[model samples]
Target: MLAIRKATVADCELIHTLAWQTFPETYKDILSPEQSEYMMEWMYSLENLRKQMEEEGHIYFIAYHNDEACGYVSIQQQGENLFHLQKIYVLPSFRGVHCGSFLFHEAVRYIKEIHPTPCVMELNVNRNNKALKFYEHMGMRIVREGDFPIGNGYYMNDYIMELEID
Candidate 1:
């Protein structure tokens, strides 16, 4: 069985652990080792996670299968009716099991509950990521491309994808 729950600030450590475990594998072939390390510390460090949760309005959800943590997703309102899907990742071992879809639907559900009308849900995905197709299949369309600098001379070369909610 799969379970999804809203993550509290106390879950930062768990989120950090899962992030470090899953992030490298997801980006290993796409990013250099040094870049990956920099990203991990910059994005998933406990302090940053705490800031994201406490001050940045990021809402996180943790997914578990048989009581074992397997994945997580985070979202935050970006505008009047626009929300950003900041992160969504599942363990490679759990891929192909529909956990991604489950988390996605949960995100949409949350958005609908809050906005209750037409809106946009968007995310930034690496242009070369295999998951690009997956997001498209879930009704997202690329709106633009970007090369966002995240410090230390690295840029996130990505497609800005959006899904309409109505």
Candidate 2:
């Protein structure tokens, strides 16, 4: 069985740990080692995670399977009717299971719970990421693509995918 809990500021470290374990592996084939390390520090640093939850309004959820932490997801409202699926990652060992889907649906549930109306959920995925199919399977469609600069001369060449919730 899969369960999800709303994460608190106290869980920042756990999220950081999960990011370290999963993010690199997720992008290993698409990102260089230097770029991956840069992104890890830039996005998953403990301070950054806390800032995201506290100041940035990113609500995070931790997913568990059989009492073991397996994945996490986060959502941030960007507009009155627009939300961003900022992060969704599942550990490699948990891939075959429904961890990713659970997290994805939980993110949408959170958005709908708070907004309770029509909205759009958007997520930026690397153009080469295998998860592109997963997002598409979840009913997201690529609306655009671009090379977003992420500092240190690194660029995230990605496709912006969006799902309309009604």
Candidate 3:
């Protein structure tokens, strides 16, 4: 069985571990090694994870299968009724087991729990990512596209996708 629970600051290391395990594999064919390395350090460092949970209002949830952690998702309220799905990743080994969908639904459930109103849930997904279809299947539609700079001369060429929940 799979279970998900809200993560606390104490779980930063766990999230960091999950990111290191999943991010590279997810982007291996799409991102250059240098860009992947830059992103790992930029986003998955423990200090940044702590800052995100403590200072940036991002909430993370962990997915566990048979008591072993396998995936995570994070969400942040960007406006009164708008939320950002910052990240959602599942271990490759768990891909066909519904872990990803569980995480995705948890994010939506979390937003509703906090705001209890009609809202927009948005996420940025690489334009070349295979996950694009997953988002569309989940009912998120592409709203725009952009090349967002992430420092160190790296740019994330992505499509912004959104789902409105009422």
Candidate 4:
């Protein structure tokens, strides 16, 4: 059976591996080959992930199966009650296994446990992505449109979607 939990320091290495695999594959068509590689390096580098873990209001997690990390998500509770889901990724081989959906569902549950007031979860998703449809299917709605400036010619055109948890 699969399990979802808050990621510990020991899970960092595995989370790095998952990010390396999932990010590039998912952005293959949406980004130039070079741009994708650059963004992956910047985002998934161990140093950045480590620093993010120490930041205030940050909650990151990993999904596992028999102790192997299959996916991860990083979120930030930025201002008032909005949780910014910075990244959510599952291994390529794990797609259609419901790991992504499982991660998303667990995220909602986790937020409910922490926030006393209504919590809003937001994520940036590519406009043409099939994952966008999946998000809608998951009951998230489009709150706005925006661009994620990842630098090095890697700005992403995405929908800023949100889900409100009571």
The sequence of per-residue lDDT tens digits that candidate 3 reaches over residues 47-158 is 9999999999999999999999999999998888889999999999999999999999989988888788899999999999999999999999999999999999999999
Off by over 4 Å in 1: none
After superposing candidate 4 on the true structure, give the runs of residues whose Cα lies further than 4 Å from its correct spot: none
Each model's total of backbone clashes: 0, 0, 0, 0
TM-score per candidate, chains pooled: 0.98, 0.98, 0.99, 0.92
Looking at model 3, the pairs that clash are none
Query: How does each model score on lDDT?
Result: 0.94, 0.94, 0.95, 0.83
Model 3 worst lDDT window (10 residues): 108-117
Residue 161 CA displacement from its true place in model 2, Å: 0.5
Ranking by lDDT: 3, 1, 2, 4
| Residue 36 of model 4, lDDT score | 80
Better of 2 and 4 by TM-score: 2
Q: Residue 67 of candidate 2: its Cα lDDT?
A: 97
RMSD of each: 0.7, 0.6, 0.6, 1.5
